[model samples]
Target: MNIEKARFNMIEQQIRPWNVLNQEVLDMLIVVKREDYFPAEQKSLAFFDTELPLPDGSKAMTPKLEARILEELALKKQETVLLIGAGNGYLAALLAYRARHVTVLESSSDLRDLAIGNLANNHVSNVDVVLADAFSFKHTGTYDAIVIAGGLEQVPEQLQKQLNTGGRLLAFVGQLPTLTAQLQTRTSGTDVSTRNLFETVVAPAVGAAPVSHFSL
Candidate 1:
């Protein structure tokens, strides 16, 4: 396949029309070699508007979904981010480019290793991939941005409590057949406002034990 052509088409067709118009987000989608992080058998689907299964039994967000979520987060060059799931590390790579640093929290050791290898191979050094459950992480400090890389009924209070002043948190909430993408901002030390971005269904996030029982 003509990789460049396919990437362009993905940006123009699947992502752009989905309203992911931020130039930086668009550039990251192109600059990050997404195929490198794909499960070998799913490399051909890297740019397609479909989810790819990851090593941990969780699925990577589709190209457009990743783009939309990235755009929603609106990361800054000097910000620090916490990503809840590491589906082969592709999303972390994209986030790392925009943020000063990214800490990817994954539950499965096997998936964590896959992400570590992929990030290292790609020279994405700004990300620290850790094998830890998102629900039980003992976070000591706040982050400028936080992203839940999979579906949950709602953004948990624990994650909400960690949002820094002026930080942003993005998540896909609700059960299957209907999930809403929400962007929440910390206006001050304890004030948060949420804006519903969109609705879509995605696989349960790896290690998101709190919402794993959700059924279709």
Candidate 2:
């Protein structure tokens, strides 16, 4: 396969159609080599429109989904971001390119190690990878933005509390086949608002707060 041609096709056919129209984002996609983040055995599928498998029962979100989240976050050059789920560090590397600083939280040891190596290999220096369960992590200063790379049965209340007054967060909510990817913003006075970006399904974040045992 022609690597550049396939990448261009991925940007034009898969990502652009999903409303990733920002020239800056499109440019970053071109600069960041996705294949470098994939396992050698799966490098050929790096640009495919599906989640690439990872060891230890985890999966990377699809390329379009990664682009969509990046676009929706609308990261500013000086803004700091907190990313949940740093699988392979691909999205974190992408985020590092757009944001001033990124702190990524990953749960699995193997994935965390992979993330560090991949980010270094790409010469992405603005990201810090932490091995910890995202659902339980908290931030006192609040970040300019937060991104959950995987879906959750329901948004973690603690996670919501970590947002800065003007921060924005994007995550996939609900179950497979009908999940809605939502972007939420918190105002200066603490008013929160959300907009449904589009529907997409991703593997649920492991250890996300389980739903109530009995619902009304």
Candidate 3:
């Protein structure tokens, strides 16, 4: 398959119709070159509307879903973003093109190395890939936005606390067959507003903060 043609189809056929109509995003998608991030063997599936496998039993989120999350975040030129699962640094590279900077936290050491290498190969300088467990990583400070690249069983309080006041988080919540892509934003004071973008399922996020038991 021709890479350019596949990319055009991905942007026009799958993403744009899903309300990812931002010109900047569409242009960025074209510029970033998703095919470069995939393994050389799997490069052909880079623009296909399917999840591509990673080294450590993980998978990259489908192109359409990634684009939808990008649209929902509504990234600004100077805003900082926190990416929970850095897979192959594909999404971070995309966010880096729009946001001022991106800090990616990944649990697997091998993935962390792959992400760093991929970002460097793509000349994506605005991203910092960290090897850490997402569930317990301390919120060194808040960010303008947070993106979870994988689905979660539940949103953890620590991750929620990392959001700067007025910051937004895009995540896939719940399990397969009933999962929802949710956009959560922190408003003034202590209010949080959530909107469901659509229904989808991707790989599950590992190392999320554990839920407390309430035994009576």
All candidates: TM-score: 0.94, 0.93, 0.92
After superposition, candidate 1 runs with Cα above 4 Å error: 207-216
Residue range 103-216, candidate 2, lDDT tens digits: 988889998999999999889999999888887655564788888877677677666677888789888887655678898888765577889889876777766854232334
Q: Quote model 3's TM-score.
A: 0.92
lDDT scores of the candidates, listed in order = 0.86, 0.85, 0.84
- What's the residue-level lDDT of 201 in candidate 3? 63
Residue 8's lDDT within candidate 3 is 93
lDDT of 1 by residue, 178-202 (tens): 7888999999888899999998987
Regarding lDDT, does 1 or 3 come out ahead? 1
Off by over 4 Å in 3: 209-216
Clashing pairs in 2: none
Model 2 residue 103 CA deviation (Å) reads: 0.5
Query: What TM-score, to 2 decimals, does candidate 2 have?
Result: 0.93
Q: Which whole-number lDDT from 0 to 100 does residue 26 have in model 3?
A: 92
